[model samples]
Target: MDGRAFLASLRTTAVTRVEAGERVAQVSRNMGVSRSSVYEWLRQARSEPQKLQASPLQGRPSALSPDGLHDLATALLAGPESAGLTGRLWTRELVNELVSRDHGVSLTLTSIGRLLRSLGLWPRHSLVTWPDGSARLWKQRYAYIKEKAREQDALLMRGGLVDVGALLPRSSLPAAPFGFHLAYALIPGGPLLFRAYSGPANAATFLDFATGLVAETGRATCLITAPHPVFDLDECARGLAGLPLTVWVRSDGDARALRPAPAPATASAPDLRPAVLGGPSTGLWTMDRLAGHLSALFGHPVSTGEAEVLLSAQNLWPEGPLPPVLPPGSPAVGRWCHDVLPLFQAEAGPGAAVRFVQEVPLPGGRTLLLAVSPDQERRFAWYEEARYQGRMRATTLADFTRRLRQDLAEPLCLVVTDDSGWRSRDLDATATTVGDAFFCTWADGCGERVWRIPERDPVQALCRRHFHQGRGPAPAGTASLEMEHPPRGPVGTADRQVRIAAAREHARRQPLSAGGRLRELVLAGPPALLTTRTLTALLSRAYGRPVDADRAVAVLRDEGLWPEEFPSVEPGPWEHETLPLYLAHAGAGAAVRFVAEARLGGDLSLLVALDRAGETRFAWYPQARYRGRMRATTLVSFAGLLLDDANGPLCLVAADEAGWKSKELAAALARRPVLVVAAGVPYLCAWPAGCGNRAVMGDQCRTHARRSRRLAVHRARSGPLLDAVRAASAELAVARA
Candidate 1:
């Protein structure tokens, strides 16, 4: 074969093989070529050049060929309405079903999609329906109306105003699928005004629209609309009754005004029209922009958000003057209400805005400015509770206020509290340090209260509770500092003894005081002993003071001497002595026993073992799992254990059954996560395992054991020697278990 012809044949074979999902290696073997050569030829065919098909062999066609299916789908989609179908769009399944039913052409759901793509009749899945009407129709109608208005030489200027009556739609917004109707009017220079009425729009809605319209333009004019019940005489009278603007309502055969008509203008009515005004029916967005436009029209900047607030206030008290909530003779506070009060209530909740005034220096020199809302008072209350009652340290109110003043860069004014506490004041205060006096209130409280003591310094501020004393109330005065008696002796042994006696007397007053009599009982006696000596001491000396049996028991439990079952042993000579002690306990019971070694002079080593009663024999290990597999060794001292290479070499070969069940690691570490329990008070600690020396996984684990020989006297007094022995015993138990 010629080289070019050979290459063309090879290319065809490679493409066929790839389509069959056969690997290059398999293809290479079948084609009698090296894998690399087959891959190279395939790559060349794909990237370098197109191969010529010898006979242009078209493979066996499907029952319905691609082109044939395309024609069928196109015919189906041309217009389902022609066939009296209700749906506007054709789904894949629908098209397939239609083709099969009409032409007896069966097509798979997947094949129908490919066929549709070929005909360019793809599905349009998402069609937005607007509050007023369908999005497409709205855009079309709006564009047409805007164009016609422009053609009539009526153009709205940036700052111009237009009295927008209502563009009442035939269908109620909510009744339709879209769920809202829009009312709007063209403003000359102001923003486009639109109000969304959820139900059918009528005269009341129109009146609302007109009132808002007048508030924006500072005057009202004739409202041109189509014949609708909203403009019936009664409805028109209701809407125009008390409005400041002269509402000349015009429709078919009905036109009237609140007052006598003015003389015909000397010239024709000024060409006042709108350019582009598009928004939802709520009119919130449109009104906001309109306010800004009004400001520009009048040569001053007006905030639409601000105008909305004022408009809301007017609506809230249509007939009455502004509310008298702000105290008399406080114009700064009153001015705060002009925009902020309504805004806060509308955005946050009712009764949420409270203004505060602070004197400040402006470009005009020293002046008093109102720092409206602040959360200090509420914050102070919380701080008081936590610091005194809850015994927690929290930031003070004064500090928070001072920081706020620094942050807002102004004397700091009003604050709005949205119900988050403590940190709320801090957040609000941060705004003031930047130098603008603004509104901010505590997160917990709804409104602001005037700063009672205006003075910043806590000390200089007069106490509201006791004005005559002329003092701040913080840390209220306590009992007299006067001593009943002087020191009994000079600074020597006698004085020290006196102090020690006094301390003991104070402790003896409370049965459950940390160093009191109850502690002594739990540390020294069993539960029965608690029923005897401890109870008697408590009843006689400190019964009326405070009783905490749990605390006392916890102390003993930490010492590994608490009675798991009551009626425990009395104190012995080795009560607090260190010894070569082996700790053994039954899993089902909480009692712990320490068996001392027979060897003398060597301080007792601490070792823990498991009880074998009913599967009670302790499975001992350095880890906290109860493993069945066991390994044993002799005990060693703390230093000796550390020095041993066998201990160092011990690593996780693999976990065993016994290792998984063992609780030794947990007990040895003395760490327990919080859990729910029944009956007993939560014993946060596990057994005699004290929260260990070092924390593991964010918790304390392992016992504290220290070895030092710095001072012989010190060494003799501390239980270090005993601790070493205990460590040795622990190592021995781990080895044996």
Candidate 2:
């Protein structure tokens, strides 16, 4: 018997003997076990006799030995390419081949799957590819911080600043018109020290709070704070000189570790009982009573403004009518509708144009200026202008107005804008010089409408919605207003051509890197599929590295490929009618096409094709079974299935690596024009004269390009550590640059 069964048999025998009225001591002596063990066994037998039963033996031994399994795991970690596999993904067939080749164990695909599962390995779908050493670096940093905190017996605290205006009553907000900044330091499971200050949150306020905290605690404080401009490290170090304090700037990975735990519920100090504060004869709290209560609680003379802020923080409202909650910009909107809109309407006469101007802030310090006429035709034009480094200047508005004037041929134009920045004296001077009337009005709650234009034309709403969705072209009905260029004549076309040439020259000078390729694609046109995921996949394939979606977007902005603005519209639930309309459009055989491509990897096959409209479409399904073998359907069959109801002749393109070589499928498609073309494999690396491995970075294979990148990061991180170590050993001062 196995060792487990033998032990179980002994336990069962001991329990039987003990239950038969024999002394526990005698049973233990006979069995050579302790009396306590016999007694425990007897008790277990009385409760659950099945507890003494032995567990069943394991199933038959695995086909591969333990050492072979270990080697298999190591191979998996090294990736499929390391084992001479074609693709990066690990499939059952690949693992079976790996085991048969390396371990000399020929296993079935099913058996290989079982073995992989036993080793705690499973197939996962992830678009993000994390760096190799980032997790290890994060763990090391966390361990170092924890060790230092433990050695110094320091209180690990996190500091934050909150705007008091968010919690204060609207009536009291004017006392600190810009809102009072409340700087707070929180000790996990300890006291919370906070102070209210005026003006913007800056380094001086943070330093003052930290200094006071150090003075109060008289203990070592390790503060974890976000890397905001308010926490300038050099300024903080100088301001907190000779204090037992250390500041750590938090990184994205360390957010969870630096998050403060909830403090204990038990009160650490005397509670300020609000009921004990007697009110006036009317039983209402006056400002004096509230201020006096706060003064006593904080042990300092509290002003009325401070008391109001404190009352709001504690959610203590005086007995009175509740303040009405109005939507943002409502008052301004009301004023504009009552007073300013009429003046613009009166100015808009025959041959005269009234354009509602809207300014949208975009990524990368740019602004989009849109001017749409209020008339039924909805004549609109937009201009993109770069902003100054810090703020929007008058020159940007002037340039946009100039461009608008060149586009619209109307002699007299009245421009209505909601942007307060248009009220600048410089902008007014420019408006007077251009002879364009500028009227600044208040925007509506949605910010898309100053006057209710959507109610007049439903097409305006649809266009705005499509632009905000950032999906397809503006719905079928909407059209851009075309106008003849002003008598400036041939200059416009020449200027545009010159600009295009300049852009081409700039692109030519740019190196053929991932960013350069992305810029080129964007310059060609705004991609039909502009989603982050799609861009990430495209860039990853082009660059031969794991590119994150967010990183792709950031690159677009940095390369000036991103648009200055897109319409902002809140998404609504999909209407029931949308699906039917989409299917009918596709069924008409005018909007979509059928293209078949061979599978790249996995059980599923992918078919990517471009439609007649030049928009990319993808269709995928499990590889079809035909005569006991996997085969894709003929192009004729797929076209008929997709466009069965259409009356027109269907156009089908069959592009595959090998599957479409059948003469029968070719003959079927021969009734019409057939073009057979060979396409390169897009999945492989594009690097010239390099190993055609899977690309994980930009256009280059990971094996050939990522090694240098990893080394560069390692050197950058290790340089500081090496310098500190050498300086400490030689007793030399290390100057930081």
TM-score of each: 0.15, 0.19
lDDT of 1 by residue, 186-262 (tens): 44444334333322233444565566555545543433333343443232453465765443333233333333212
For candidate 2, lDDT tens digit of each residue in 7-116? 57668767766667877765664444667888777877889878888766688756875446545654664446666875443456777788888878888766865675
C-alpha lDDT of residue 658 in model 1: 26
Off by over 4 Å in 2: 1-139, 150-153, 161-182, 196-200, 232-234, 253-737
Candidate number achieving the greatest TM-score relative to the actual structure = 2
* lDDT, candidate 1, at 251: 29
The 10-residue segment with the lowest total lDDT in model 1: 169-178
Query: What Cα-based lDDT does every candidate model obtain?
Result: 0.33, 0.44
- TM-score, cand. 2: 0.19
Query: For model 2, what is the error of residue 371's alpha carbon versus the real structure, in angstroms, after optimal superposition?
Result: 28
